[model samples]
Target: MPPQPSLSFTLPSIHDNTKLDCRIYQPYHSNPSNPSIPPYSSSSDPSWPRHAAVVAHPYAPLGGSYDDPVVHLVASTLLDLGFVVATFNFRGASSSSGRTSWTSKPERADYMSVTGFLVYYMHYLTAPQNHARSIEEDNNSPPILLFAGYSYGAMVTLQLPPIDSFLSHFASPATHTAFADIRLRAQHLAEEQSTMSADPASPRKSLGMRFGGDEDLSPRSRGKHRAHSPDPEEKIRRGVKDILSRSKFIHRRHHSPSADRGTERNIEVPCLENVDNLIRFRPAYLLVSPPLGFVTNLATMSFSNLWPKKRKDGRTKNLEDYTKREESEVETEAKLTANPTLVIYGDHDSFLSIRKMRDWATKLSNVEGSRFRYVEVLTAGHFWIEHGVSQELREAVYSFSAGLVKS
Candidate 1:
């Protein structure tokens, strides 16, 4: 294959009627420009694609999305290597809901939803279903599903906790209520900020002044600055005013808490949603995905150290910062050692670490005495450059996935 094949579509993510724009690449068919993409029989019964590999993007707050060249490259790489690839944005990222937060519950749900969607589309056709057909292949199909992502995306994947225990977390009144509240807050926050900024009397400058510090910024940027100098209320008023003037801009650009874009909201809140999530994961692939730096901080910070510790009187110990976390540092045993998992951590991954990535592959995920795969691409940073990863690096991805398919 020249590269592999890939395709995009809008699929239902949040609800049935509302669709999330998604791109599903054909399994391992990289060369879209090729004379022949994989031939699909037009019969009402077409073939079922591979029942594996849901690909997610890195941190959306930091410009990561299903469409990023880096994440898609991996999707295409896996597609070429013979796996069904599904890529999408976190709810607030490209097009999915709520806000992009460290505890990416909706995002993870987005990933899980792909598995159900692919399986339904491909298999439902055989009996009383849609036009999708099962691809002619051997019968010993395994229900094995593979989930993976890069950087922020990887952290999202590792968040996949056990189904049973995880469900209870959602069922708890407090956690469920908190999640609903968070979702509502995100929506209103997006709206309130927008409405406040649209006033005709709003200042002439862009709110870039609030996030602004670098005087070296271009004139165009400075022109957009909401306040060149500020009073605190004026700054807030200007930013809220700016938000109103541009809803779409704010929805896509604004990050949470700080309300600034490009910030990664990976810190787990002590809220029911996050504490439950941290408590439930396999803990094996915790720091597996590469570009080591990107993962390590998230992993190390993942400790109870990030959360506020409590004392015997049921009062929580005070942290220097008002921000508090709920989870106490707890011992976690590895869960994924039994499932063969392949992880790819790019050396350039800034959010997470590569050493942790290799360690994950060789130890935790693979350590369960399961089949393991590792790739350290040379001359390649986090995202494989458009120029292309070095041939050696390219081979590692393809070769490893190919072996994965065979094994």
Candidate 2:
């Protein structure tokens, strides 16, 4: 069977309205002709597993983009395991519009926007009317969401708000806003894809094939290719405007006097309510070559409290206060320990010492009821360039994802 094509789109950053390039790959089920491929379909089978993943690349200033080799490796591995995978360019990376921030707050918001889109997309795609009934009557399992990252990206992922907090922004977004538009767009595209998946002969005019050269091409080469081909960015901008206009129309109709009089009620309420119910998910995390020590501090620009400071009363405050994390941070840590998480790093990493990484892993693993696990590859560097390191990395990712699906 031919490889499934990816759907490329642009989403606005909640921080500054910058356009971020994004792609989503659908999972492929095996064909009868090919027995080697596994049989799994999130679209057709109501009982089939429903899983989605969002992978963030390394730092932008260090030449990171959605096309990074490691990012692609992780995405492909997840895709093979029946995951609907998503990858995106952070601000100032590749075709995305903006400059990298000194502090990583804006970048964090960028990740949040993409994550929100995927959540709603999967919700609408999997929650058919029959599926909804089965969920309530048969007590079917909820979907799974995995938030994975590499290097500097992992550092940012670790600092993200809790799952419920991250999803609350979409529960009741205002009309005509970016959040509202994202919800609408996700529903529209998901419905379209679901229809196509149901009918195998349907023509996929919008989806483009993903070639090996496209995935491995350098950023410079990609720019040159974009210069020659028809522009997708402009087409995406027009689509965004259409969705925004549609949202405005829906808002007006929903607020009209007839709507309140029980004559012209909103049509989307039923679907949105079902999506709300389907929002319950088992969260998972995957961190590959996560940065540590000074590299982490540099990536997050968090040097302010690195040293002790004198108190206003002329007494030096205890340094322990600095180590005390905020409530959100504490909540994030709790979620990680409570759920399945996989951390993979190399012993010969250049950016961080092995001792520091080992200590960090040991501390997290020692926590009571911690499901966190780590794998240290021998002679592997930060980039996983050692001879057999990439294979080992892929195996670890596959094992972690398979376990989640089976459980």
Candidate 3:
């Protein structure tokens, strides 16, 4: 089948105020009268797909982009399942602004900005103000948002800021100045990290493994590796400590403006109830071959560890501060446990070994609710380049999404 037509646009990253290239892949709708040509709609059409998705590409340094094969595969799968998919280039990748950071902290702004744009777009389309003919004629409801990321992108997605908090902050006037401050802090981090040789500039060098279709591992091998793997709890604890230490610097720079300035600004900004209405759409997250070690380490870390501290007196806090506080009150795993989430990886995955994948499954399985599940495709590598593996991944994701409706 031919690829669906995608609308291209640029979104300013909240981190550095840099313009990031983005594309929205609208689901295919048949043109009955003119079968030879593809159907097109400039506004919301009832016949068009309802749910929307924002998919993050894999690691940028390793040739990952909005155009990556896996990204397209997932986007296409979601589109086939009746969704409008949005994909974008992360910082330092393609034409996006600023260099990539070692951790997922900086990408928080990028993810939140893209999410905010979609939420606001949906709100506008559904609002009575939009005069688009198709929308007025059809009166279709808005799309539900889904956030899916692969590999390094998954790491960033796992650490995404709280949605309500992000929306509140985005709706505030201090957003620009806050973003400017984040940009400066990011620039400083980029300068500091540039001197270090720790960052991996590329994916694994097993060219034959990645492309030759000969590196697939067996389920037995995966089981043996899992049996021999070290206890995940200690490693998780150590990782959390290290991540907290590293994230301290990032949090210190996220300070909000004074209470008086914020109060004065809040009067001009939309009310809390209004902001909530604007962002009524919530998102379900899917992680494909996420590096378990990285995800688990940061997933449980509190927002207080990465967000600026507020004074004891409630007056010192603003919407952003309160949002951060609200997020800090809950554990990341607890939040995901409350929502629909899926984690998929391969027995022979390059990014996350089978043993680590098992570890994540075990850890997340302990969550109170059965809101999380995982699928392991046998003989498939991290990238799912082998024949039929991508399809299996798609089916897994689709099934998970379908299950979401049932729950």
TM-score, each model? 0.53, 0.78, 0.62
Worst 10 contiguous positions by lDDT, candidate 1? 275-284
Residues 1-407, model 3: lDDT tens digits:
21533344455677767656666554545432233333223233445444677899877777878778888778777766666667778887886767776555667678877776666545443333344433443653334578889887776787785577776655533323543222222222222222121223422111100110111237787566457764433333343344334432311223335567554221232111222244255468898888766444454354555655566765444456557745743556665676677888889876665786797677786767757777889989988898899889989987876655333
Model-by-model lDDT, in order? 0.44, 0.73, 0.59
Q: Candidate 2: lDDT over CA atoms?
A: 0.73
Between candidates 1 and 2, the one scoring higher on TM-score is: 2
Q: Candidate 3 lDDT (Cα, whole model)?
A: 0.59
Model 1: how far residue 90 lies from native, Å: 1.3
Residue 196, candidate 2: C-alpha displacement in angstroms: 3.0
Q: Could you give me the TM-score of model 1 versus the true structure?
A: 0.53
Model 3 ranges off by over 4 Å: 1-5, 30-44, 47-49, 129-143, 174-279, 294-330, 405-407
What is candidate 1's lDDT per residue for 229-271, written digit by digit as tens? 4543334345444533443211112224545766555433222
Considering lDDT, which of the candidate structures 1 and 3 is the better prediction for this target? Answer: 3
Q: Which residues of candidate 2, in runs, are more than 4 Å off?
A: 1-5, 31-43, 130-138, 205-276, 302-329
Candidate 2: 10-residue stretch with minimal lDDT: 267-276
The C-alpha stretches of model 1 lying farther than 4 A from their native spots are: 1-19, 27-39, 42-49, 128-139, 162-335, 346-361, 365-368, 386-390
